[model samples]
Target: MVVVAQQTPSGPSPLSVDELVSALELRTSWTLMRVALRSEKLPIGLGWKDLKANASETHSIAMKLRSFLRDYFEESVVTGERYVQIYEIDKALVATIVNACKAVVIPASPFSSKYPLPLNVNLLATAPSDPTLCDVRNHQNGDISFIFCSAGYYDDKNSYEYGQLPTHVQQTYVGIDKLVTVRKNYYQSYDVITLRTALDRLEISVDQPGRLGSLRFEARPMEILSACALHFQSLQGFGACPPENLFPAIAEMYGDHAAGKVVALAFRTMTGSVKRERMTTNDDDLRDERFHHAGMIAVGQDIKPYEIELDMEFTAPGGIAGVKLAGMMSQLASANPTLHGCYIKAHQFIAMEKALNRLMTFI
Candidate 1:
């Protein structure tokens, strides 16, 4: 019998790949031009009309304009030194010039056959809110509860998904489809006003640390913390986790410390913690507390008659406060069996924050 060989799946043809790369490059150039024009607030002249009028010319007007800008910028200099020179026409001006060139080169309709790639026409457009995407319920006590459900959960009998979602949402349905896969299992709700107030407090604290003492925690702290966790996830790449799972996980980790009292969470670098340590001669000097801890203190009766206050602290061992938090949680879980749940929650939060910070740099 003739030996039969196993067949492997075929990849895209080279021509197809080349076409995609070319299309993507063109799209990227157009996107950069649009961003530059909007950011610099550059004025568009009658360049397009002039180009159309000179369509019969042997040499295109667009090519002539581009050549002129290149020569002008190359010869211009603001400061000349032996080793270094600064251009008189800065990056912003160069961007403006490039955008002007694009006005002549690119057609007004981005969907034209000249550029085969799909153009994001609404890249700078202000998105309209979709009421159906989120459900907001108002309580008699004037507190509003908000629940953002994945669009897939509300699919019609015909299996057609949320037609009303924004165009971008429709394009990435494959990825978003996973988010609503188990929507019911992880569905969670939050008090809208309370959440907003907590975020406002966070913003103020970041701006003015001296005013931290005056900040109020009247709203549910879990709502605020959960929102932070969600923001962290969105910035990072954990977009797959549904709100239902994310909120409950946050509540379980820090909920006990935050419950029935005002709680403030802060990160300190490992170097700062080490500098604070006292010099000890003995080898057995108690190792500095490297895990989560809480203490209670009496803050007087004017503070809503609460008998005691909770001060929650977490120690990390690196220069970056976020990294230290992650390391501390790992050490805690390994050393103490009792704090396994707390470690899980804290680990997730720090990991999310790190991911978010990475994502911000790209933006």
Candidate 2:
């Protein structure tokens, strides 16, 4: 059941449950609910008329139903991650919390038959436990196979995009199809050490590099997860999405075995964010110590030269060709002077597919 606020010429006003019922039943302009239990389908204790009434019992049931539905968002089924009170209502209303506006469906059944069939046996056992597996598990071949599917809306058409993930991180990560400008005032620039600090706080792991860009240490399970989460958050504004909790939940369910397998899968896949830009700055504001990048990095005077460092040890999945193409474009922008704009085109599914393929390879 949806509780909608009544709107006036000026703005929306707080509404009672009875008013929400009136709006829903009458299909009034105040109705914002797109889905609700029909009158006939109401639970045993409640009916359409009961919801419509202004009586105490009506309000009581309405509140109870609302509360009951709200509970759905409180606990994660797979990981048991509970939503904080601030986002409780909003989280419960949406299907999957990851990028609410993007309509990325993180499957409920994990056993539904859809596209992207025939998972690899190795990946199935290695994939972090989640409902996402439902899409592949229901298929006849899924017993020995696990599949991960990511769909994207480009312009308006849907297409399959995939990613290649790191071999050792046991997490699922996906990027949105849009670019999000980071709020310069809200966050400080983070280097590898600071980034690791944040990951440790969240109980995530990352590969322990002996030095910057060095592979002396194996990947930290949490650090890889953090990079995936941050990449997703940067590409798409935060909402009810739950990808952040995916890896940890798998760790809890299967203990170290799950964790180890996931990390291996991540490194093997090298899942990272990639985008195309027809591009690109950083300013160190003293008091607040915030970093700001302006225009395109290609044209911007504040462009950091160090970003060009290419540690090619990690292989990008989806396909080598696409990864190489993007890398080439980035290099071209950095070296060429007369180039006006650079176009970097990447499909989001590439990341998802890469992660899935690595999971399959490991399992």
Candidate 3:
């Protein structure tokens, strides 16, 4: 059950479970949702337009959903050595694993022959333990398959967009989906949560197992953005959609495993606000400090002087990334034009995929 505020023509009002199911259009015909897509059967659930007026943010969500539904996003791809491998895969085992996954998220039921043959797997798994959070199926070809992890999380909180906002360090991180930018005298602190999924546009992998019948599916970012957008809209006091808590990126992201070490080590200064000191420069400052290009550092390396990119690595003795000691980063762009800001990007020691055999399915 969801607890959300809705804005009706008469103002805010309560919404019933049935009303929510209809208004939110929970009933889809196929693919990601559980409902069937037979031509003869009428679609379930009334769309928001049919009910009360939806939140203004809902339109934004709709637009993002439309754009994000692509087969791939370069950011979501776990390039280089950003992946872990699995072993002992067999042709016979594939069916069992596939069937088990379907059962885990979908209930067994009798169906007609006209039932969609080989329906794509898309559904939430909230079993209270290691649940399936975000997934957008791309495609499947024999043993080779792929997917896009719509949900995104950084091991370091400061690397996230909302986390980069100029707010007190004591700001509450809870109810992140409810975060909205308040255009007041000073920027209001917001919870570090979503629609930020698209910001990461995190691309994962579809690895090929050795001499083994191993490989996998397809997915996208649109679904993830749409989900977060709904969650954001719900908090708008217009209509509550999927709450942010449903996303593992905000609800259960951890420094150890869920978020790879690459994401943890990343510190984002270039994209968001770059001011280090909150000391205001102007008297009529709506923002805490002046935003400079100090966060964006694109320079050349030692030998590759011509190679241009956000290549300059900000390094220090202990570590170049992290919120507490981030200021200690002395490595700035030298001989670089954009000297004001520092460069930060997810780094991997190796430049290629490294394989390690494990018994796990999810990474």
Candidate 4:
């Protein structure tokens, strides 16, 4: 597991975001990543704040929320890079939470901004993943997850602006540099040995406040909150669940093991490779002869979105499907067109009948 520093631009930093982007060779584009839910149809009474996943991919509640959302969140009509995590909540419930009585959020996104008021529960919790893999005990009594996207979701590396998404963190990472800072007293380097030592010396108590929050996992405050929103959106998908039972389900996912590893990976180098090593120095040396600055850290290749997977298909080697599953695969072909092959989602494949449904020819 890679360990990077939780570097946030406060007053001023040594290395600049542009410099980091250039050094890391980051793919500079406005791509809106995804976080999926395990259900059918969108949640109810939810309103649209921006554009839907697909213009053709519908969401009925959006149309209904138009007028009401005007007061809460103003839709984005500008131009530039932005992103959207596919989820929202019941408008009535949201109204109640914001207007009537702010129900006690035992905890929002564990990494929410400290400066902000109303305690914006930033990071959305992810759930309904491979049930076999769930750590029920850890996440059972209330857990939070941030894995917001599934491999099948599409990402356009060129669309700086998401039709309806407001202008937000133009990129998943403010810059590749922010993530690669895994060294101590060194906020902008990727020295493997330094990282190993740093993690060893680091002490994080989930029971303690402010440690993880200071180690932010996402770019902007709202983006993280958007993540927290995705969790509620997923709850809406669990059909027919009585409110009595829902609270327990919510608690179970809170204590998940994701808090530790997921965060490290989010800031990991795109290729899992480090550039420069952190300058090693003794405690006395630091107090005596100051150490090197972040500007000196060496940069490596681009750091793509974490857990980004493409859903595609190919032919068997002997001319079955018509694709050679070989070589390095970075991205996908244009929308609707399989990169020289056909593709089907696992769910779609399972839903297909073993035999074809013969249609009658009515001439």
TM per model?
0.15, 0.16, 0.19, 0.16
Give lDDT tens digits, candidate 4, residues 53-101: 2211224553332221221111111101112111123545434323322
lDDT of each: 0.23, 0.24, 0.23, 0.20
Ranking by TM-score: 3, 2, 4, 1
lDDT measured at residue 125 in model 3 versus the true structure, 0 to 100: 23
After TM-score superposition, the amount by which residue 189's alpha carbon in candidate 3 deviates from its true location, in angstroms, is 23
Position 311, candidate 1: lDDT:
21
Instruction: Give the C-alpha miss distance for residue 266 in model 3, angstroms.
Output: 22
Report model 3's TM-score to 2 decimal places: 0.19
| Model 4 deviation from the true structure expressed as Cα RMSD, one decimal place | 25.5
Q: Give one digit per residue, the lDDT tens place, for model 3 in 237-267.
A: 3112222111112111122232222111222
Q: Residue 291 in candidate 2 has what lDDT?
A: 28
Ranking of all candidate structures by their lDDT, best first: 2, 1, 3, 4
lDDT of prediction 1: 0.23
Return the lDDT, model 1, position 313: 26
**Candidate 3 Cα lDDT to native:** 0.23
1 or 2, greater by TM-score: 2
Q: Whose TM-score is greatest here?
A: 3
The segments of candidate 2 whose C-alpha lies over 4 angstroms from its true place after superposition are: 1-9, 12-18, 22-44, 54-245, 251-363
